[model samples]
Target: MKTYNVAILGATGAVGQEMMNVLAERDFPLNKLRLLASKRSVGKTYQYKDQVIACEEATPDSFEGMDIVLGAVENDIAEQLLPHAVKAGAVVIDNSSAYRLDDNVPLVVPEVNPQDIQKNNGIIANPNCSTIIALVAINKLHEYATVNSIIASTYQAVSGAGVPGLNELNTQVTQVMNDEKVEPQVFPYQIAFNLIPQIGGFDEMGYSSEEMKMQNEGRKILHHPELNVTCTCVRVPVMRSHSESLTLFFDKEIDVEKAKELLANADGVKLVDDPNNKQYPMPLDTSDQDLVYVGRIRKDLTQNNNKSLTLWCCGDQVRKGAATNAVQIAIEYIKQNA
Candidate 1:
């Protein structure tokens, strides 16, 4: 096996830290690992197996002599620095929405489109975590029955917002328990015991930016140019992992039993669909893991045909959605080149 020098652009955030952990967990061949963050986090240290890695202030010069740079930062920071990494001859697998829709950058989910990794020109963009999970849960069904339309309602965890979001939820819950006034900051409103229907700014059509991603990124990744998606994104009080309810319309007929059979053996997906015993995919059980757990299989009564069905899925957005996805892309890149 060969090793590569890798750097994580946003080494201190939730997703960045998960990326580091996933690399170690999956035993990514490593010659060197560099952690990069803002000036405030410059001296912070993190645990990676037996080594204590210190974070450095990210600069254009930081990408020099690196085989790969895994981006786990916001779009603004990624837009500012990733180009420099590419110019310095390092392939970047970004977890941000910075270049997801770019014609040149491939928005990848290894379970859905591993071949897309080879078409990258020094950059590979990981799709939104929700998009990744939703697509992974249904990709096999799409293959067997040709998914034509998607109806999704996402119950996203506070961790989707990062560390501050998690802290806000914790603080609010504690304040509520103490009968104190709760201050809303990390989210638009109190997310302690209530749900926020909006995840991002709403468009003229009343769809949030996060909702539109289910369609836009899904179209790009699945290569289903005509795929239709109607999505509703809600911020729930859960701590980690995201759960989605999906109603799919396929071109070909597919029964509930068939859907379960396909998903049970699908790659990157775990089947937990025994409803008789009250077992189904849930965020509480799916957190801190890579595979998307899918269950609650049933025929969509509203569709009026065998061509439509519904299912539920859950995945750790921080891991499978961001960090782990980028690391998997990097691993594929390494294997493809080798």
Candidate 2:
């Protein structure tokens, strides 16, 4: 078996750490695993299988001799650093939105568009966490019915905002329980037992930056230039998985049972639909895992024809949305080049 040298940029962060775990969990063919982060995170130790690797400061030449570089940093840092990885001859699979829409970079969801991986010009962009989860749940259906448009409302977890978001939610819950005043820091308002309707800065059209990602990123990944999406991204108090309500309009009528059957056999998706049994996808059940749980499949009540359907989905944004998806792309890239 051939092994590759892999480096993880932003290794000390949640998603970066999860990338290490996923590599080990998936037992990727690794000759060496390097953890790279900012200077402040240098020397931080992380467990990967039987080895404890210490973090190193990421420099311009850090990616030299690396076969794969998984990026889990913010957009600014990604913009500044990832190109160097590419320049150093590493196939960079980035989780940030920095290069997603770039003409040369392939935005990929392995199950939805694995073919796109081979088209990358040294960089492959992982779609937004919400976009990844939604697409994984619906891609099979889309292949069958040819989805035309989507109306989606996302209930994103605090973890989507990273460790700080998780800490803020925890601190606020404690304060509220003790009858103390709630102070907001990571979020615009208290996220404890509450929902924030906004996930990112508002656009001129009132859509948030996060909301627009669904429409824009979705179009690119699905390769459906005409696909329309109206999305509302909300920050919920849930600790891990992000859940979404998706109403899909397809070019042709799709039967609910057939949809369920397809999803039951779909890659990266788990069918949890059984309405009478009160069984469906939930964040609690989907957390800490990679599969996107999809359920509550039904015909759209507002649609006169059977061309529309509604469903619910949940997935661990930190994993499938960010870390695991990047690793999956790397896996596909390896296969394509092997």
Query: Each model's TM-score, in the order given?
Result: 0.99, 0.99
Kindly list the per-residue Cα lDDT of model 2 for residues 1-338, writing each as its tens digit: 99999999989888998999899999999999999999998898988999999999998889999999999999999999999999999999999899999989999999999999988899999999999999999999999999999999999999988899889999999999999999899999999999999988998999999999988999999999898999999999999899999999999989898999999999999999997999999999999999999999998999899999999999998999899999999999999999
Q: Which ten-residue region of model 2 has the weakest summed lDDT?
A: 160-169
After superposition on all CA atoms, what RMSD does each candidate show versus the true structure?
Answer: 0.7, 0.8
> Which candidate should be chosen as best, given lDDT against the real structure?
2
Note the Cα lDDT for every prediction shown.
Answer: 0.93, 0.94
Q: List the residue pairs that clash in candidate 2.
A: none
